[model samples]
Every structure is written in C-alpha cells, then in structure tokens.
Target chain A: MNGLNGIGVKVVHVGGNGNAHAVLREIEARLQLLVEKGEEGSIDLSGLPLMPEDYDLLEETLGEGEVVAEVHSLGPTRIHETGIPGVWWVTHYNSDDEVLAEFIEVAWCPEILLTPEDDVKDGLEALRARLFELNPKSPLGGAPSLDL
Target chain B: MRDETLLDTLKRRGISRRGFLKFCATTASMLALPPAMAAEVAAALGKVRRPAVIWLSFQECTGCTESLTRAHSPSIESLIFDAISLDYHHTLQAASGHAAEEAREHSMKQDWGNYLLLVDGSIPLKDDGVYSTIAGISNLQMLKDAAAGAAAIVSVGTCAAYGGLPHANPNPTGAVSVSEIIKDKPIINVPGCPPIPAVLTGVLAHYLTFGAIPDLDDLGRPKAFFGESIHDRCYRRPFYDQGKFAKTFDDEGARNGWCLFELGCKGPTTHNACATTKWNGGTSWPVQSGHGCLGCSEPDFWDGGSFYKALSTPISPVTGAAAAAVAIGAAAGVAIGLANRQTKAAAKAAHQKATIADLEK
Candidate 1:
C-alpha cells in the first residue's frame, strides 16, 4: 500500500444497548475483577456515541475500523438469535496486550454525556498515554505507529 | 485543374483555406511536434498532387468512420480531403457497383507505387473471405491488390491492428490482422475500438511532414500515444495505491469515489491516450464517469473477462492475520477505519435521501 507504515492493527468493536455495562461486565466476568466506573464528567465517551448527532459523530460511530455501529446481520442460519440489533464502537488497540492484561479502563462509550466533539482537545491523547502505561509493551510491539 | 496544387484541389473541392490550416495545426499539436512544424505540414500538404488513399473496409462496423467523421475538433473533412487525396473509400465514395471497383483500380494505376493504403477493418481468411465483401470482390483480394502498389499501409482500428471483435472467441470467420496480409509495406496500427481522431491525424501529419512513419512499438503501433497504459495516467490511481477500492456500484466505496479496480477496470493492461487526451473535447474518460475501463484499445479486449475485474495481481496482505495486524496498529488502520465509516455514512445518507423523497411523493 502507498505510504503505509507496515504496522497492522485491528479495530475490535464491542457494543450492546448498554455498552459501558457490557464492557464492564465482560471485564468482570472474564477476569473476575471489579472496576470503578468513572463518573460521567470524568470520562469522555463522545467519540463512541451509539447514534448519529452530526456528520462527524455519525462517521466516527459506525464501521469496523475505529468506530462500529450495530445493524441487523440477516445471516442465513439462526437468524433470530444472532439478528438482534446492538450498538457497536471500534478502537485501534493492540490485541495481544489486551489479551494479556488482567484489567484496564477504556472510554469507548458514546453515551453518558460524551459527544463526538469533546471539550478536551487532547483528551484522547491523554487516554492513549494511560493505555500505554497500563501495558508498557503495547507501543513497542514492532507495529508501525501509522498514527497521524 | 489537372495541374492544380493540393490546396487548389481542396479549394476546388469546396474546403476552406482556413480549415486546411486549422487541420495542419491540430495535426502538429497531436503529434507533439513544434508549432513551426505546422508550416512544414501546410507547405508539404499544399504542394503535393492529389495523393491516392485506397481505404479498404473489412470485417468491422463503420464506427471508425463515424468517429473519423465526428472529428469536429480538427474535423475529419480537413484530414481526409484537404490533407490527402482520398481516392477510394466505400462509405464516402459516390460511385458504386462496377464504377467503385474501377475507381480503386484507376486510382491505383494513376498513382502507382505511391498511394497510401488505409485499412479500417480486419480481413477474414475463413471460407474464402465470405465474412465481408464489396461488389462481389473479397476484402482480402481488394486489400492485396490495393496494397500491391501502396507506399505504406495504415491500419486504422483495433480490428485491422489486432483482429479486434471479429477475431474474438470462437471466431467463425478466421479473422486475420492486416499485418499478417501486408507484411512488406510499412504498417502503422492505430489500435483502438475507434482511435482518437487526433492520433490518426497525428500519424498522418508526422508521415506527411517527415516523409517517414514515426517511431513504432513492437506491436507496430505508433509509440507516441500507445506507449503508456491508461492506469499510469489515471487520477484515481492514488486511491488504488492506498488500497482503497469501490466494492460495488452502490456501496460506500463508490460514494467515496474510491478506486474501481475491484469493479473490473482494465486500465492497467490497456494502453491509450484516453487518460491524457480525454474524450468529447477533453472533458473526462470513462472512469471519471463512474465506469471502469473495458480495455477497448488492447488486442482482444472484447474477449477479456469482466470489465470490472482488476487486471493486475492483488496487492493486499495474503493472510487474514497479516491483514488484521496491519489494520490494527498502523495509522492506516485509522485511515481504513475512517474510510469504511465515511463510505458507510455516505451510502446511508444517499439511501436516506432516496427514501425520504419516495415517501414525500
């Protein structure tokens, strides 16, 4: 690919009607640990909105890359059980670190007063800093940091 | 009248002097020659006596003529009548039946070993050349006879250049290219479904000015225009290089104006001036209009697979894990994510607009 950094990343989106609840539950259920869900004001989940408020938010809230939106799959078999509509949000993070770490705080929820546009311009940048701290080797995984 | 200059013959035939000059200039520019060369063109074309052009139509439609006549930029009239002496053309000639045959013969005899052989279609050797005929004479016989005394042969279409559509799959006519028949004479293959009129005129202008054919490719096509593939000049090639492709006509990729390779574009394999020269007064080529290249200028393009399939090898990561790894870490991952999202949103918006309009109605 042209101008590629050669570092591949996957945007894994996990969503449901109550994404915060679901993510919290998954972390708890899988690792058997409790997470102090941050207060609504302290956390910025505007970039992860489940619904479209504007063109920018709508763009960020849907698709497999960085954001994901839930839509009916309409697959051939077992359509009823797996066909239910759900919220989806995508984020580019190292999967190996995510798989290795026992617990971590992530703010991908669009609801809880988070808009696509946030008051903190560098809030995502700080969140990235915290994410890297939790797993020191996350950024050193030989993946090209194609971050613009 | 017999001793009239070429310009005087054109004037007697009702072609304007200004039209003749315009044709000369356009020819010069098309050939990428210096503007000063136009004077050389006008001088050479003005002094020569009526040069004989024996045009043989073989196994193909008259699209080449239609395109030729529709050359309003320089105007085909200026090229055919003002520039050279078009002695025999089946479509344009007034005489028919025995008189038409006689006209070709008389012109051949009149300008022996000097006339130009302009072939617009391919010849079928199958069943004794029964695929196409004129006045009870096979195209093969007429072409051979016309070519016998001709100085050079100009194959004007893909049919004549590379056995175009008639030579496609299960070809019942056993169509053969003009190169196969007239090997001795200098053959210039202008291979397009109907090549750009400017290209045709350019070749003629170069020949008329220099008294020799321009440099030709291995395929006998003039190297000036057919040297580069359409893909090399396509504006959308950036999108292809970035790994962006329009998956379907109505998809987000299409709405985002992504690469059309996934949709079967033959731009990579097909060489032509369409990308640079453009069509209909240099407005846009087919890809700009949301259609992929069908590779019309290449040999046997008609028999090629679906027009939307990309001609080159796939360049994306081979394995899913590899693709996912690249997708997850690289900023390209962000771009890929953004591209997918943007495409989807655009599609959704279009769908919404259509639905709302329908509901309003």
Candidate 2:
C-alpha cells in the first residue's frame, strides 16, 4: 500500500467565489482600451486571489485562439492568444519550471513577443561572424563593418 | 557580484530585457505596489548595487533562517537573497570560530554605517547577558556593537521583534526585543513564528528599490504584508458570514472546510500575509491545512492565552440590514483607528525631518 495506511481520501467540489466575473469585467475594460486608443494593458493573475474553479471558469470563458508563442530567456514563458482577439494569456516560469508570474494581457501583441533592439544588433553581429567562419576568403571576412 | 549592479548581474546571467521586465512586474505585484510602479521598480532595481547584509542569530532557534533558506533556489526570494552581499551569517557563513567573528567585525567595519543588520531571536539581558554568547561575546554586547554603526536593523522573527516565548510568563533570561534595546535606528519587524520567506524578501526588495524602508504598520511591520487581517482575506469568510463553523476536528463542518472561528482561530486579530501569500510556494497555510492562526506575528502572543480558546469577541450570524450595519461599523472603527495611527506616524516623521534639518544646519 502506498503510505496511506487505509485512510480514505475525499475530494470536495467548491464553486467559484465570483472573482472570475470581476476579472473578466476588468479584462473587458482593458480590451476596450486596447481597441479605442491602441493602448496595451495587463493584469497580474498571479497577484489575484483566484481559486482553481475560478481559473477553470476563466479558461472556459476566454477559450483559446490560434497564436501560441514560447519565449526562452531566464526560463520558458508561454504566451497564448485567447479566443477573444487581442487578448493574451502569459505565464512566466523560472529555471526550475516553477511559475514565477501569470498575466492576462490585452494588446495587439504582448511586449514580450517583440525582439529587443539590442538583441537584434547582437544577432546581426553573430550572423556576420558565422558568415566569416563559413567563407574566410570572402570580402565580408574579418570584423565586418557595422554599416549592415 | 559586489561591484556589479543588479541589472548587470541579470544581463551577465543571460536574462533578457523582457525577462527583466517580467521580474520587475512580479516584484511589483509581490510588494503590492500598483502595476504602474513596475517601471519605477525596474529603474531602481537596475541601478541598485548589492548592499552588504550582516545576519546575527541570538537567543532562540534558527527557524527564521530555515524559513528564508528553504525557498527553492531561482525563486524570487532566493534571487533577491542572491542579489544581496551577505557578509556575515553565523548559520550560513563558511567561516567558524574567530574567523566567523572576524568576518562579522570586518563587514561591520568596511561597510560601517551603510550595511543592513538583520537580527533573529531576542537578546538576553539577565546575568550580564551571560545566558547566550557567541564566541564568548554576549548577545547583548554583540547586538549593541553591531547596531552602533548599522544604517538600519531588521528584526527577523517573532523572538527578535517582540520578546516571544522567552519573554513569556516566568521569564528567566530577561530577554528583550531588538527595538527595546536599540531605539535610534529604523527597525522593520518581520515577525511570525518564522516569517513568510516572500515577506522578508519583499522587505529587502522594497529597501533596495526605493533606498528606504517600506511603509510600516504601527508594529513596525511592512504595511504591504500586514495591512489586512487574515480573517478579512480568509477563504472561509463566507462560511463565517453564514455561521457555519467546525466544532471539532472530525466534524462534518470540518470535513466541508467551513470556518474555524469556533475552533479558536486568531485570524481576526492576527494581521499577516499568510492568508494570501500562503506557504511552501503558495501551496497552503495553517488555515488551509485545517488549523487556526496562532497569532504568532503579534507581540506577547505566547502569553496571550490558550491557542485552543476562542477570542472574547462574540461572533454570530447576522443577515441583511444587521450584517450591513455590522460591516459598516467595523469599517468605520478600522478607518478611525488607521486615521489616528497615520496622524501619529506623520507627526513622528515630521519630528525626525526637523531633527535632521537641524543637524544639517
């Protein structure tokens, strides 16, 4: 027997505390703002007191959309567009795969999806170095000019 | 780590701008700051150099240290702890004997009036404070010595914040809290049996982000964490409103996860972040695990009364108009009390400002 010693386990079902509806209302307002003014907004879901059933209700209400993105930085971040257009669900995790934060983002595109200018520059430099390594004889050879 | 700013360290560790922003946003939420303050936190945290911290353990158990260190690595608490330059901690430091004492003295001298001095457990005052000594140095003497040049002091546990168990009835050691002894420095009390890991780290983050202590309650606790009573935020509050309570350990109400107020829950009077922040990485708190709050965060809680005995305040079910009136009355009382405390705090702040201005002049 798996450590239970004959103790019975019971699972209790509890209903939502109406927190999901409140969150959905806030999301609606943020979505409206996103539409009218092209403004981006996010609610920190991790900070709120949402129960498991509340989370289920929210998921069921929002549904899911087409776009799904994963960002690997400090850890993996999952960004999914909800069924509602311009509404996104973002969950950040640490290296140990423990959730660090969760957000309900309302925007055309979440900020985390955009490539930073600095990283883009670094990527360009890396690409140039790779090209030089592939063909050393080429004029694009050593210490390629920053004009590119 | 000592020379580099937090931003530089994060960047060196391959954390991207987006990652850093996410961390900042998480920190803002953890600190209960407005979402708009995330940018401010980011700006401040990026520029903050790791400040030296000297953690001193005194006349009690090391539960506080364990509570802090038990958080899984790479978690927010651990990350914030990592960002600090921990110059001295007898429990965690590698040095021993004279070398350990030497490190403490060295950090104290080097950082002088700027380093953060963290203290867990109370200092014994009886018998020339001979009861508890580290390397032959009495806890009282060491505390006084370290506190002399420290910029601020953080009393880490209930023992160090209040007198705790040692200072309960029939006290032998004549133990006293850090505040009772050291009154000059700004002391932030993170009091619990062992404070929530996030609460301690959140205090540290607030200090690092703003270059000042977070706004504190009347008890010198960070108001962000201790602002609301656990009862007010408890999941079983609806049950309490409906007069459903667990009378015994194996009662049907207990099985149904009803209110534990009848079982002597101190959540009503006890202010803490546990109801919301939970424990063991948001897993469960004492109430969630079918136990009542022990009011461990409050002063003299050990001597307050039996933990199993319900509070003197009468709790009864009231509906409609009566419920609304009760709620309004409680709210008004709380508001008035808070107003009075705020006024007093403001006066104290003004007095300190004037004193500083005088010193400058």
Candidate 3:
C-alpha cells in the first residue's frame, strides 16, 4: 500500500507494538514544520515491524489519486500518484508476488515513473520502424500522418 | 497568616532550586501549558503566600483521597501540599472532633472570601440531609456554610462533580453534586472515580499560578485533562482505524495488542488523562493493563451497562466479506501480464553473459 510521504530524513514509525499514534503525532508535528519551511520529505519505513493493518493505514493516510502506472523488470513495480502533488506511492514486488520494497516518494516525479533516456532512443527507432511497416513505401514517409 | 514563601520552605527542607523548577516543569506540561511557563510558575509559586485549602468529605468512598495521598514518590506533591497551608483535610488531619471543627472555622474566618474550598463527595439532601453528617452538621448545611466565604469550590471527585455512584440507579441517597447547591461559585470539576494525581494537582498549580480557574469544559471539568476522548489519545487507536479488533480478552488479537474497541472499551466516549498521565505514576492505565476503559470519568458511569460489552460492532462487515474476498482475490490481480514485453526487451538490451567478476559488483 502507498503511504503518506513524510518529513526530512525522519521515519515516523507506526509500530504494531502498541505505538498506535506515534506516527500520527509525528506527522502532525512534521506538517506543522512543513508549513513553516515550505518543503517536504519522504517517510522511511524500513525500520520496525509492520502488518496488513499498517498497509491499510498507508492507503488511508497517503490517499490515492488518478494516474496509476505499472512497470515490469524483475517483477511488477506499480507507481501511483497521490492526491498531493509531487507525492508518489511506489511498491516493487518479485515475480512470486512477494513484496520487495514499498515507499512514499516525494518529488516532482519519482525517478522510477520516467523512462530512461537511452531506452527512449530505442522507442523512437521502434516507432519509426512501425511507421515504415504501416506504409511499405511512401513518397513522403508515412510518419507525417502519425498522431504521435 | 504565615509569610514564609514556598521557596523558603523548600530550601529549608533541602529541596534545591533545580528540584523545584523540575516539578514546575512537570506541572506545566500536565496542565497542557507551554514548557516555558514552568519558570513563570516557579517564580509565581515561590512568592505566593501559603494559600489555605479546606477539604470536606460527604457521601462517598475515600478512593479519590486515596489516589492523591497514596501517590507514589510523594516528595514533589507532598512538598507542594506542604507549601500550601492545607488548614483542614479530614483524612490527613491529626485533629479530632472539636479541634477539626475549630480549625475549619478558624481557616474560614482567616482566609474568608479567599480560601479554596475542596469538596470530594456528593451531598445528600434526603431526609433533611441527615444521611451523612460531619461534626453533627448535615452535608447540605455544612456545604452551604463552607461555600459562603470561599473564593472558589473544586469538586474533586465524580461524586462531588456529577453525583457519581451515590446518585447511580435506584438513587437511594437522593444525592446531588456541590454545583447543584452552590450555584454562585466557580467550581472546577476534577471528575474521575479517582482522578489522576497530577490532574487535580495541575488544577491547583494553575490556580496557584494564575489566581483564577483555568479554562473549563461544559461539565465544569478542566479542559486540559478532559479535552480529548481517551480513544483519540489511545496507543491502540491505529488498530481501530485499520478495522482490527480483539474480540475477547487473551485471544490472538489481544496477545498481539490489537484495539479493544470490541471489548466494550468506552474510551471513545470517556475523556480523561489516564491514557497520557497513566496511573501508578506513569506505569500503566486500564487499557495498558489489558482491559477496556470503564469510562469511570464520565458522569453516572456506574449506570453504563456491562463494561465487557463492545461499544459497537465496528468490524462485523469486514469479517462478513472475508469469504467473498478469498473467492474474488484471484480475479482482482493486477493486469501487469501484457506490459512485461517492454521490460523483457529492456532486460535483453542490458543483459551480459555473467562473468565471475560481475558477481562481486
């Protein structure tokens, strides 16, 4: 589940061991500081024990927005944009559907969501070749009629 | 009137200035004031005259008194009480009969129209208030008499504040709170079966510092302590929002420290500092000890049925859908199969035959 992006290098832990609101209080405090500083940061959740309930909290707290994109490398890595701009919910999993990593990335756009430049070059060539196939031969190259 | 200031007394008793400041800091935080106010509290408290406090008991158990008197590590609280000229407290005073009566009268006359009058139990007006008497004076009569010249009255327990157990169902004593009778005075309700030690003390500290009653809620309860419901401040609240609950005590959920909302925890409605301040001096409160809140702080809580019953079934719908969820779980899988070609192409472009040196990298 996507979590609320938190503050500067600070991991507000929502532990299952009865620290029910430690994270909520930390979030409240960080929100107060964010207003003063006019910047944001991500919540590091690598520490502490987590559970399904914790995932529900992440979903409820971060809040989902439109624009979901899935990437596949080792496994499916889904990226979701949250209601807040510059906030992203990223979850990477292995082929077995076992979660590898999950994080709330805070930025203009998470690096994982964008295609790398070298890969884009290949995409350009593939699109040109598709145009060549669409029209076996054309006086002015069929790419001129391409909507993209 | 004794002119020796609190600072003077504490210094004589070997309590350093730092010790007094630390106590003031704890007092400030407990009262929900900014930490910086501690110094101001210390400065104001150190200069003030040992204000006279007259404590009266009526129809109730002595649990409230026990909470304060039996407080562990009573040094700081004791010193503060010592700093105050507690002219009369029935349970703590060494005087008997006429002497106790005379001391009350004396303190009343000395600090007339200024002394703090603390009432701990509900006053019964039944049978011409003959049910409970102190010094042969009816509770109603004694209450009216004592309230006459007091600066303000503090209803120190649920009984004195909201006619606690004595006014519960059947209402045998026809008991009433101090506010029901004394309508003119400003009353501070520190209502709890037995209020937290620092809460009442915090109210006293506020009064001692500001010379006025702190902000109060509608029920005459102090806003600082009773401002938020126990559920909001509870440590197991995440479990509630996550729809996880412990159905019965000692179940797996209970052992996992899940929310006890299903176990009739009245924490959602009850307002008190027990969760934050904790009993046994920060050791644990009722919820921390593995039980739902009994809502003891609320008015007429004794009438609230069976403490083990859940507040409401907040998780029945989730449990009802578990079977359906298991069936549809496969169909709800992510549609990522078709998108794998681009990833495969990218991997093929990046792949290199493994060499022994690549393993190290």
Candidate 4:
C-alpha cells in the first residue's frame, strides 16, 4: 500500500509488453537532445501503454535522487529527481488521490515547480497588507525595524 | 446557473494555477492530443461558460450512466460534469413528473439551438413508438422534439448509436439508432455496451476546447479513441503473431497469457481505447483479466455471432495465404537446388571425360 495525498492506494503489479526498453531508449535520446540544445523535454508517462511491470522497471533503473517535493493544490503533486541529474518524475493526483497525469521530464527543473509571476505579485501584496495590519504606525516612518 | 467561467469556479474551489494546468494536461492526454495542446485547451476552457447539457435516456439499462459516474472524483472526467450545466436526466435529476418535463422544456426554450443533447439507448419506431415513453411522451416523439433544438447529439452507448441489444435479433419493437431518426444535427456515436468514461469526457473536452466535434471515424466515432483496433494496440499481439493461443479457460496457454483470438477474441476487428486507456481507472480491462473481447463497441455485435466461437477466418486472409506461399516457395527452392546439383554433377563428369580424352590424344 502506498499513500498519496492521504489516500491509501493499493499498487498491483501486472505484465508488460516489453516496451520498457523502448521508453528507456526514448529517455536517453531526450537526454541527449537536452544536452546538445540546452532545451527541456518531457514524456507523458500516462499517455503511453505501459503496464505496472514497465513502470516498476523504469523506477528500478532510474533509482532515486536527493530532491523530492509535494505541492498541495487541488490535491497533491509529487515531483522528485531520478538518479540521473536532469531527469525528474512528476505525478499529479486529483482530490481522490487518483493519478491524473504523470511525466518524465528532462530538464534542470520541471515547469510545475516554478512559481508563476502572478502568484509572486499576489504574495508581495499580501505580505505588505499583513505587515501594515500588524504595525500601521511604527517608528522609522511607519516601517518597523527587524530589531524590534 | 453559475455565472462564473470554469477557471473562476476552479479558483473559487481553491484550485491553483498549477492545478488547473495539470487538469488541462490530463485532458489533452485523454483526448490523445500532444502535450503542447494543453495550453490551448487551458486558454479555451478558462474563459468558456458552462454549456447546458440535456441527457435523455430511453431503452437503456443505465449502464452508460453507471460507467460515467464511476469516474474518480475531482478527476478531469468528473470536472467535465462541473463544466456543463446538466439540465435534465431521469436517473440523476432531482425533479420528476411534470416538474422534470418542465426543466427539459425550459432548457430547450432558453438555450435552444445551443444546448448539447446526449442520448442513450435506441428509439423504437414501430407501432407508433409506443414501446417506451417518458412523461407520457413516446420515445420517438421525445427524441424528435429534443433533437430539433439541440446543437448536436451525442449517441452515448451502442444502443443509441447502433440500435444495440434492444434492436438485436427479431428486434421486437423495430428500434433504430439516433442517426436513423435525427438527420439534421451532427451526431457523435460513442458505441460500446458501456463506453469508457474517459472517452465520453474526452469528446466533451474536445467539444468544449475547440467549440467543434473532434475528428471522427467513418462510423461517427471520435477517431482519437476508435482509430486503432484493440488487437493492434493489445499487449497480447506478440502472442498472436507467434501463433500462441489460449484454447480453454483453464489451459496452459491461458495461464501463460497467450492470445485469445482462438477463443473468439474480437480485438482484431473491434476498435476502441480500452486496450490503452483501460477501464476502472487504468486498472484492468477484459483482455487483461483473461477474457476475450466481446466486440461490444462494434455495430450489431449482438447478432454478429456466438461470443465463444472463433472468428471464421484469420483477421487477415492474406496472412494465411502468405504463410502457405512461403512454405510452397521453400519446397520449390529445395527442388530447384537438387536439380541444379544434379546438373552440376553431370557437367563435372562430362568435363572429366573430355579432359581424359584430351590427355590421351
């Protein structure tokens, strides 16, 4: 049993069609392209006709890396780097913790991890509002010093 | 009657930009579109208002509705329902009697020529269509009335698409498909005993994203889901190619996961996304569970033949002929080789005699 977004999921292993090697070859090619062109690329793992065994094979071969994260949005999105430096595994799950999409991205960082410009702008305004509410009139012309 | 756009609704529900993006990517993948198209889908879906949808059920077993509702919550498939204002459905609606009929009429009058019409099960035509009736209105009359104002009609199951089980052998009520009755509006046929939930949602997503129906095959099915035969995309195809087959349910081949073609697997001719998209949220489909395909998506599958009988001939007759030709060609090559050897041996003997005579001279 594996827990995703607080939901217990039973993972069942099944047979494959021997396409895991082909997918590995594709990843290698994509990695090479990333190296030569300095361009990012990704493969939609959910779109492929891969079985549980194929997924297991890919996971075993890729192993694990240092970085791992969980982004809570609609539900939860898990993103982790594989053993390879540039390869990342990203999975998006719905509120029920069912996998909505999965991808193998070859890039410095997956796109979903980046904070949107609008979000940053909103965050700045929110922080300013909260600070003003905390100290409407403080020393140094309404700006409180960190030493306080 | 929510006035907010889809994006607004998602935002109100606390879904972030990343979540929406993820939903769009999943939608694109479900529709078999490239990942890049997810942006386009997002742009279109974000601003689009919910379209009014009217679901009409006739001679059906409620299987299609059951199949659709089985889609996991908060999933993209379920989100499609949130994207649409479902005005009327006998099974899912809260209203009934005249009130139920009133909602259907109001939706037609309010969103006439724009509302999407979804029909399941066949419509009986014989005997003045008295076999089935909703709110005292006959199935035939109700279909014609509803179809008149619908922008387009989606025949959800094999029944509404190809006159399914109700129109099987004997076809007591002389039932016919929606296309046989409604001619003006464009109809998308999603034929299956009960279609995959994602397929119906994919069609809806394509329509919602592009404001037009997706590319369809000759049978009016979305080509994205019906383009490839199950056998062609099946994991057991290699077994079929190697002539490995499962003869009985308990046979060694069956236990070893061999091809089910000899066991009346209709995957070779039946086209659907089951082999890839799979059923029960990518868990398993019939073939994966060690059962032969029933060819449920094809037209007239009920009367096609026995489910247990093997296909009369190989999927492609030419394949059998080619195998026979290869064998005959191999035999002919051996015979020609023997003849060539004999000729070479005789020529060598004659050359020896000639050389001896020359030496004597």
Interface RMSD, candidate 2? 2.1
Candidate 4 has a TM-score of 0.85
Ordering by lDDT? 4, 2, 3, 1
Is 3 or 4 the stronger prediction by lDDT?
A: 4
Cα deviation of A91, candidate 1, in Å: 53
lDDT of 4 by residue, B1-361 (tens): 4555677767766777778878777788888886768889888876666778999999999999999888643456656778788999989999999999999999999988988999999999999999999988999999999999998999999999999999998999999999999889999999999999888988988887777888889999999999999999898898899899999988989888899988898998899999888887777789988899999999988987778778775333478789999999999999999999999998988874357768898
C-alpha lDDT values of all predictions: 0.64, 0.85, 0.74, 0.85
**Candidate 3 structure quality by residue, lDDT tens digits, A77-131:** 6778877545677665545444434455555565555665645766776777786
The runs of at least 3 residues in candidate 1 whose Cα sits more than 4 Å from the true structure, single-residue gaps closed, are: A1-148, B1-25, B34-50, B74-80, B313-361
Chain B TM, cand. 2: 0.85
The window of 10 residues in a row where model 3 chain A has the poorest summed lDDT is: A1-10
* Candidate 1, B1-361: lDDT as tens digits: 4344555655665644434544454455566554446567778766655556788898889999887775534433353456477778889989888898898899899888988888988899999998788888898998888888999999999999999998998888999899988879999999898888767866776676566788998889888888888887676676789898899987887766677888888888888877756665443468766788888888888877656556664433358987787767787778889999999998988874357768888
Best by DockQ: 4
Worst 10 residues of 2 chain B by lDDT: B312-321
lDDT of 4 at B26: 78
Task: Write model 3 residue lDDT over B56-169, tens digit each, in one string.
Answer: 999979999999885543555666687678999888899989999999999999889988999999998888988899989999999999999999999998999999989988
Off by over 4 Å in 2: A1-11, A135-143, A146-148, B72-75, B313-361
For model 2 the local lDDT of residue B101 reads 91
Docking class of 1: incorrect
Residue range A1-148, candidate 1, lDDT tens digits: 1212264643222122233443334433423222344421111132111211222333333322433332111111010111111222222111111110011222334231132233253455666667677776775533333354
The alpha-carbon deviation from the true structure for residue A51 of candidate 4, after best TM-score superposition, in angstroms, is: 2.1
TM-score of chain A, model number 3: 0.61
